[model samples]
Target: MLSLWDSWPLPLETAPPSSCSPPRSSCSARQRSCSCAHSVRPIVPPPATPRASPQYVHNSLGAHAVITNIDVTLRDGGYRNSFNFSPEYALAHARSSVASGFDWVEIGYRKGSSRPELTDGLTAHCDDEYIAAMAREVGPEHIGIMVHPGNLGEHDLDEAWSAGARLLRICFSPSDPRRSLECAQRAVEIGYVVCINVTRISTVAPKRLRRIINAVSGLGVTALYLADSNGSLLPDEVHALVESLISGHELAVGMHAHNHLGLALVNTIRAVDAGATWVDSAVLGMGKGAGNLVAEQWLAYLSQRRAGSDRFDLGSVLELSTRLGESVVEAAPRLDVTDMLLGYFDLSIEHSPRLAEIPDRHAQVRAAGLLAGADS
Candidate 1:
């Protein structure tokens, strides 16, 4: 099957002008009609909107997902951009997100390369000097980096801390909760606000979930997150999970929902109302597959509940979205049948076997579910 681009490329071609185009300054006189000029969508400058420090956010926004998702946008958002964000882009967005009243801005991944060629750019590698410079530019109080299990050892955590990051969020598969928790423990000892994001939350069994929760009960991390990795959950399910986490462990609970079922925003709100203090989202809903919740939408919702239109300068985020919509290569998030199917059946299609043989995504998920059912 053809990829989104290979199958359909016209609109996406227009969406990434700067990345795809030749330099306009060097264009010849006859190049006035160059495809670059035709394809590039002009960004509208945001009006001078007033900004106010939000109340209930404390002096500095603490380690709450509700307040800080700049990191989600920059770090997770890289999936759609091929982790190809420019340093200037990262710096600009960080400044905007911080000024707009965000507590933490996740800069990028501190990942070890499995395939050297795949890791590229400031967003992907998140070099020490590079992110340190970003923290210096935006103030390091809330700058965070995400590390995978086995990606970094104790020594690497020290280096990550010295590079001006105050927060370290570690996410790993639910199948390997012990390894992921170990990384979070080391990060906490290294003196960073650590959040352990457990992927595939919706599918973990009661016994398995209990073991993981028990393991996390005294880890000393800042927060524990249940990532609805395939977006395969309902609002009630989210509430129940949040309640279960609170009852089973001492960790401050958080939720990370994907847009696969078009429920990320609602699930986040439900989780928050159910006593979750943290949540995660991506800018313009940019992330892998169906993408994460939209950061602009999340902040706007927070601002609305509090009575301050300028609380976080949400307009700036919208401006950023418009700017990114004109530059990022990925198409915007939409309801795809297959994605919805994955959510409905509580499976991650991306990890399903025999995917190549299944031409349609919905069918791939169906097959995966059937196989899972048979195995059980």
Candidate 2:
């Protein structure tokens, strides 16, 4: 009996363009045809009995390795002082992140030039020279960097790779699919493990998202990151999106969540359940507008659930979170039930700023406008 999984023909219409590349000219005609043509039916090999999914299937690399990498210094912590991370604090965070068994400790952005206001006393947001020094201090295996696609040029990318950045996150607005793919391909060419981040994904359509995933999958980048830029995604939505990306593409999937709706932790867990191998988190959830998934919360969940136990240190992570909160005066973003409800419905908060200010019928109208803007 042929099952759906057995000898299933590749869906040409949905296949990635890069996957359609012609076979090598050196191959024999028969071999080339067999390898390249989706229509070429091949003899079915004998089937083997199915095995149960591994216990660590939800974990990264199936090696009891947790994919919870801390990016506080770059994203969350940046908001604390406007990317004004002190060198001492940055060094301490790096050492702590690595010592706590974190797979990667993203230092900060490689923005083309430094804005003095944004970079005042900040070690993380410096040029490649500073990054190279930090990389030497933290070691290449633990250091990573984030870059906004619009801000970073090709030369900036080349310098980052030279500075020992093993991983590079390319952030893109979800509305622009072509730019996302182009950035991912360019990053790949420059020899970085590229992760394409679809920022503000709450505003995108499900069908359009599938197309973006397929397009970037064709680029053969390292990962695809679904960013809840508005901190607006619910747990079920996170699970559904992660599942769709994993099922449709060969690339690894990750999530960068914000806690504006207080769903960041659950959504991160849901992403893991839906086959996401990478989860971006911050210390005390200190990020833009709202904040991100808290590193300590994730560590505690893993410890209590007995998941990814070998890859995290709950005690150390808790201590680090405390220090980070104190270092930056971490404050949770002020979000109301209305904002939470609207966010769950894929609505933006720009609609009702006065809801918090005045809390009246007129505020409700403003919220409606925000939702309308998303649709428009």
Candidate 3:
């Protein structure tokens, strides 16, 4: 699958100028020809009036809350099973996700490699073929996939579209604004509903983020995702980041929160309050490292805020969550106060291996001191 990454080329060509010239008119016996005859004539087409911007139509749900999108495949589910999932497990999750009224259920990653087997005959990752087959098995109307920039080439994009992927969550490193723009442009050109993810945004400068947002906005991508990969951002920080990104960009904004600080749900809500139209969550908060925003918590929050709304069926979602948790038993890494404090200070896990190696109360103090020393 990695070899396929080389197949997709960036489309960046402009239409060539017209080459045909208008025929010259000859003056009859009595009149002299105009001296300006040799000058280039401007092509006159009808003026095009600008179209109105698309207004977001709220569902029956009140303005205070909205339905959330779910990612069901091993990428999000991997936190529970160590990146291992059976095909039957994938199918069951898909069926449950659709029955629960999720806007979309991201099926899997379109990657080249694969693990031998996860629980119940499922693989740790999925490719285009498996995704397409599963889409057929579960029905394609609600299936989705997540793609990393430069992971899949143009052919993979074509295959994904052909395999019935209705939405794509495209992820990119925050430091590379040019690469993010290029990825968004390519996804748009290939006719995919692209959600550009700026991963590890907490480490980025506000001005650099603003520039990246503007660049993505100009690419005509469907949405921009503010991903806190390190799980370190506070609710206030999340709100401020969302507001900053939205103030400068015209595209719809979304949030993907990690649960390192156990504040994913609140941060997600804060993001919505700050003008984000899309909110991403996972069942049982099963995702990378400390996990993601909990689907049940977000749904319950929305239910409480917007009672008597048709936007979501919270009861069904809870049922699905219960079944999935029971089926997958792998323990996710614990995120303690030290991890939270490190995140709050913008320190990565790589900073202090000793902290991870040490146990008891001293680890936290040493981790904090190590982080402070590095900053100094």
Best by lDDT: 1
Q: Whole-model Cα lDDT per candidate?
A: 0.65, 0.61, 0.60
On residues 1-376, what C-alpha lDDT tens digit does candidate 3 reach at each position? 1222242232322112112212222422111010111122222222322222222333222344333465543566564465566677777777677665566777766552222233222333355556666666556556677765545554666666665666777776443445546666766776667887777666555545555565566667777888887676777767766665565456878888888778888888778877777777888787766678887777677656644345556778788788776777753335666566555544554454545556666556655655544543
Each prediction's TM-score versus the true structure: 0.75, 0.73, 0.73
- In every candidate, how many clashes are there? 3, 1, 4
Q: Which stretches of candidate 1 lie above 4 Å from their native place?
A: 1-70, 112-119, 173-178, 307-310, 349-368, 371-376
Model 2, 88-121: lDDT tens digits are 7777877677666666777887672123234434
- The CA lDDT at 123 in model 1 is 77
Q: How close is candidate 3 to the true structure, as a TM-score?
A: 0.73
Give the runs in model 3 whose Cα sits over 4 Å from its true position: 1-68, 112-125, 174-177, 331-338, 349-354, 368-376
| Model with the higher lDDT, candidate 1 or 2 | 1
In candidate 3, how many Å is residue 93 off? 0.5
